[model samples]
Target: MLYFIWQKRGDKPLNKSQKAEDQSISYQDWQQFFQEIESKLLRWRRDLHQYPEVGWTEYRTTYWLGQELVQLGYKLSVGKEALVSKARMGVPEPEVLKQAENRALAEGVPLEWIKRMEGGHTGLVACWETGRPGPHFAFRFDIDALPIDEGKEDGHFPYQEGFRSRYRGQMHACAHDGHAAIGLGLASWIACFNKVLNGSYTLLFQPAEEGSRGAKAMVEKGWLDDVDYFVAGHIGLQPLNIGDVVATTSGFLATSKLNVFFHGKAAHAGVEPEQGKNALLAAATAALHLQAIPRHSQGATRLNVGKLVAGKGRNIIPDQAFMEIETRGETTELNRYMVREAKRIIQAAAHMYDVQLEIVEVGEGLGGESDKEWVDIVQKACRNAIYVQHVLPHLQAGGSEDATYMMRRVQERGGKATYMVFGTPLPAGHHHPCFDFDERVLMVAVETLGRCILQLT
Candidate 1:
């Protein structure tokens, strides 16, 4: 059902029929949708790629997407309107968050949207309902980019063409840009065909997904309150051909992101060194001990100190230092154990070095158990679609994803939910500078999801 057209590079602006590795696909279930939204999908992808934003700080991205979805005839809720304040976890300090909002305002985000999204609370929920009433179905799409410089390599397509990221140190290295495009494409389908569609539909364009930050807040805000069935997905996991789709994904590692700070009195290295309490030493010691945390005998476990910075100058006993770390485990209980041990190690290091220490959780996500019956539903839906050539029964996820937070919530309240992967060929692995995917996957995702929603409702 899927085939690749190997071609030598002789490009005059590649199009639907071309292949360099030609990462293009042909769709079956929705032909008019192909013609109607195909060009729009590519346009939306590039426009978002050009103006990338990181989690929580996705002010402009949220505003733009909100406007578009509302224009497509769906009712929209954003910022504090859709998010609960006290429920927001792992938030940056007020001033730091304000700067990001200010930057978005100066860059042209609508003031109406900006006002609601103040303090970096950026995400939205769009609802399309048939007044006659039925079960409410939900689809989630994450909308945040990574903090990496867009590759300026001349051969890179984004740079070669006109739509590369305009932001200096932010780029859509992950496929959120594509995910947003797919969500919007799916919205168009839902809006245009609502009369024929059953049940009510809700689409979540979640913010700050990079650190497992956004979904919990939405869950607490009751975003999935009435959801009867829920589905969420990512673009690519491991490598696969253009038309492969993982109908059920499990084993998203439960994880926590933490920021550690150590404070002490600074002093000159040669003068009164004895008066100084070295924070740098305390932080460095804690980092090493954190990594040496014993592996769980029960299930898989992981710990990493992704960043450590201290010391202002060579002549000073550093009085301040910082560390950013994350812990992961195959299950939620195991992750909690690692976090507990980590805190103990940090407290001991602070006492030994006579420095003040603070450990703050900036983000967190719990592991999930994919309901087998829900998997069967998604599998049957994909198998029935012409767009999917392979319907993977069970492909466990290798990384942590916050979508499970919402999934668990829906399931907790007598709802059925599952996370799937819209598998597609990639030019490079996720989070790499050259990451890109076959655009045809967007079309297939719409059709497959549409089929599933239709079947469920």
Candidate 2:
């Protein structure tokens, strides 16, 4: 385990007469702290990038993070203890999960930890209680990779630096590796400054964020029920400078992901053309009409059939077809409208072809906005960080995030919540095969968030 308790004997205390620049931790102090921890940040990010995990199959990542936090004197809640077992969404099949578990075990994750995460329960919550009176603060960091193969070309930085993903078709194309690194860095800072801090801190390492699937389970487990302040941040959403940070965000669209299947009678295509129902045609028709869902007059609505698979051979009529579809809208009502329309179109297509249909909802999320009070608090913290060159008051996300679940849960119970953006220039757009960001943003995020926690407490 990495030693994170950075206790120095000659540190000075804050003075009322001192200038803002001469606070307890000044520019020089931040610089020194970053210098001391830069190597560990880079190491963590690179290792995670090379061995990326996806969704509820992040056994190795969960074990590694849990061990680190345990070494730092944190109390941990893993697997079903950290998430509601029945509430998890978009989980893989039992066989896929078992394969992932075996891989983690082969890679040296302990059997005890593996058993705890059996059945796709793979999230963690770490807490530190100071036994003093103050506000409870929480930070969320997503720990899942996308289902994209990493670029192996010489031009890619990870390939050039020998840290490219080792798993086929699994890569950290969304900078979740960087987010996890920043979470560990902030955890170290909290441990180092425990003497000056009071109250409690909770860190949530969420899984399956790519499809907006993880946060609801964590929230349903009551992690945010007692939170006084909650914050979550993402990296490289905008093509901004490494040190630019957005304190708040808006325009997070509500979304739903669905898996639709069609069943039909199979017959020899050439010998009995009239005896079979064409499942492929039904799926194709549904895919076409799903894209044509009328846009809502009240707000922006979107729909897509991302994947479709059907047929066994050219000589036989396909008996089964499957489709992966998604719908999004500016608000919950608008999204619901799109989903209802898509379902109607799908049912009509199945009926027209005389095929049986089954629709399964895989993921969902709600749109949310940050509380202005917490946004101002985070902005002030960003302004104080020496590594931060620009502080943006607000940003338009143009996407969906499950973090909205936690944010809404906290706000509903009279607490404050905000989603932040640690801006960094990306070499490619998110989810692309070559997606990567400037690693310097890692420390900048840690410093800004660490300061925010201190300010809140």
Candidate 3:
């Protein structure tokens, strides 16, 4: 069945003449269109950066995108919810793959993937089709902000320049603003010359990536059923020169976040100390023991207690306590081991202190290993594009992403997946108050993705 689907998607080998012609046309058209859309792309990026929204609440952002799509002459369909669009690929059927290939050959640029999804109110998919036939390719972009307040004082770019977020306490601290804008820029440019693409393609604008929820929901809802190849990128604070692309070769750490609570009797410190069980003491003891959880000798492991709250009054023995904790490892088996060991230590501490204990799982993310075939394609594409430097292959990474859910899903269904890191010079590291990224790197990312799509399709 899988082989049949591959053949039907036009995964057959191309002759030398056909390949050369396709590459020539794709290169010429991309250069021309990128030049035409540069200004609009920059403006769109700035607009999104100025008014950031958090997670699933990208109301204004989604609305603005919808308006843009309508202006571009694409057929827009409302998603299951508001602030979302399920935009269809352009005319030409027999599946989107063939149409995209035909379009790429004819127009010099390829239009393989563009489909809008109904990912809550903030999700959208834009699909492009060439008249020829082939497999479906997908590129995912996450568009959501963090819960931090935007820079408010004078001298900050957003505040001083008068482009700060209208929504207080919501900002694009994680650089997702750039991601959304780049995706939109790609969509707009691709739509203009849909005649050269060889196969079907879908561009997914996902929401709630901060909470690690959106990608899984999209998959469960069948947003990737027809996708054969999937790709996504993220902006980071590494010191690599602008436009340098980094691809991870091995799996990253799998993480599980937990909240542990302990309940006990409250009493006066001096008068009723003997009658009260100290939940605060138990929680503290558990936290200390948690730190002692040995880092696995076989693979990397980590345990962190980020937050702890115990008592309100100095004179009273606190009755309740809670702590936010995380356990991580290089693989699922190791992560599970660490979690189980931590749980044992917490339970033991609670018993010793005579306090009731509860553990709640807050968020979880699995690690991902790069697909060698897809990585090679990305490397070649980056090498071919200007302003991009291909660094050495990554051996392992500690970064965690919800996109791993999408990658795993695709693998389960017999598809190829690759996640790359697009380097941008930043003054501060990720998730920091001073985090900032150079915008020029985005142009390289856009060019790299465009080239990769052309080659793969």
Candidate 4:
């Protein structure tokens, strides 16, 4: 049994050999740990899948995780307490946030837990330290869902198993549910065997990674301020096999996520349509032109206006409109150009429509370029796992992740960082309505991460 009380924080005197002996663990021990925690890990993943919440609105998710950490005697830094305010970009309106909270309440989320994550904050860090001094190590896990309806057909595993998302129109279409499960499982593992570690470790449950939002705030707060190594991985991206893991991967596009609002005077459309500036028309116009922006020849570029809403009635001239827009490029320089052009087009549309315009830069994700040296550490870690049949040295990461922001900060300060792709068999592609991953992959990932923490730190 693991003890509730640990020796203390900070360094304690110990001979080199004693420290080495303390850190040692055999392959048999790894299998034993996996068997002990595997079932509970799968249960956690199912529960999370049933109650998916979108970015910045992951109130229940954070509370669920925070309570578990406390039970394990882990010191938790939560919500506004740990976040840096100025670094928070691309946030939704106060009303939109309030509505999401109300829905969570209606769905029977615990009142006390909801109260803890009241603001638009949902990320947290759980830290643990052994008495022996060593380098600081960190692992990040994203804990947000997507805005898609869950497929309730018989073929969908969630529906068949009765774990479909309770909140209608929102689903864990990505692997975040699996990711969080692995994160919490690993936390439990470390707490149970806390004495084996020489260095301190922190697990970062990040929020709003879907739109490349929410990570900058954590970085700005100096979350990665301490010494040494960092690791974060995603499931079912480039690695499609059940046991194949990608040790080193790059190609995360730089992106700008923007939310724009157009305000104008309302008037009856039939009686005095000219008296009102058409905010709806302006938003729609901006959407069409935004997509038509010229693609740069330097590399790959993408532009999208995912959502646009306006107009209250058929006869009334719409007074307000809101739209979400984003642009991406292979490099930071190219992404900047796209952002500049997008702003110019938005301004021109507002001018032509004679409406007041507001554009909020809610989230950003920069292109990723990982350190080659870090790959060796991850490769060595995966080799220790019996289930990891093949370790692909490199591949393209294929999508945008706010983790790249965290990686950039760590690398800038001379600390090493690498984001990995953990393999899992998928029922459908990510962000799709029917997406699912094999529950067994959860154990494989946690065990590999455990080994990495050992060799790296």
By TM-score, the best candidate is 2
- Candidate order by TM-score, decreasing, is 2, 1, 4, 3
Model 1, span 185-304: residue lDDT tens: 889988766766778888999998899998988888887988998888888878776567777788889999999999988998997899999999999999888878899999999999
Among all windows of 10 consecutive residues in model 2, the one with the lowest summed lDDT is: 1-10
Q: Model 3: per-residue lDDT, tens digit, 1-457?
A: 2223224433431111212134535656655665576666667777887667665555456656766766775444334431212321111123433433333234332221122222233466666676588777777788878777776654344565566766566678888888887787777756765666677767777776774656665666565766788887787735666656765545667777788999999999999799888999999999999988888888888889989999979988889999988888888788898999999999999999999999976566677887878667767655556546554455355666777877887777888887777776666666654566666656667776777777676
As a TM-score, model 2 comes out at 0.94
Residue 262 accuracy (lDDT) in model 1:
99
Worst 10 residues of 1 by lDDT: 17-26
Question: For model 2, how does the per-residue alpha-carbon lDDT over 1-457 read when each residue is reduced to its tens digit?
Answer: 1122111212222122322352556656565666678888989999999889999999999999888888888999999999998888889999999999999999999999999999888979999988889999889999999899999776677887789999999999999999999989988888877877888999999999988889999999999999999999899887987678888888899999999999998999999978999899999999997777779899888888899999999999998999999999998889999999999999999999999999999899898888888667866765545667677888988899999999999999999988988887677899999998877788779878888876776
lDDT for residue 323 in candidate 4, whole number 0-100: 95
Report the lDDT of model 2 for residue 27. 57
Model 2 scores a C-alpha lDDT of 0.87
Model 4, residue 445: C-alpha shift (Å): 0.9
Off by over 4 Å in 1: 1-29
lDDT of 4 by residue, 1-457 (tens): 1111111212221111211121377655665776678667878899999999888898878878887889988889887765775677756677877887787787666776566667677778898888678888888999999989999776777888789998888999998999999999989888877777788887889888888888888888787877478787888884376667777778888999999999988999999998999999999999989987899999888889989999999999999999999999898888998999999999899999999999998889998877787668767776546656567778787578788888888888888888878887676899899998776678668867777778765
The residue ranges of model 2 lying beyond 4 angstroms of the native Cα positions read: 1-29
> Against the true structure, what is each candidate's TM-score?
0.92, 0.94, 0.78, 0.90
User: What's the C-alpha lDDT at position 90 in model 3?
Assistant: 15
State how far residue 80 of model 4 sits from its true place (Å): 1.6
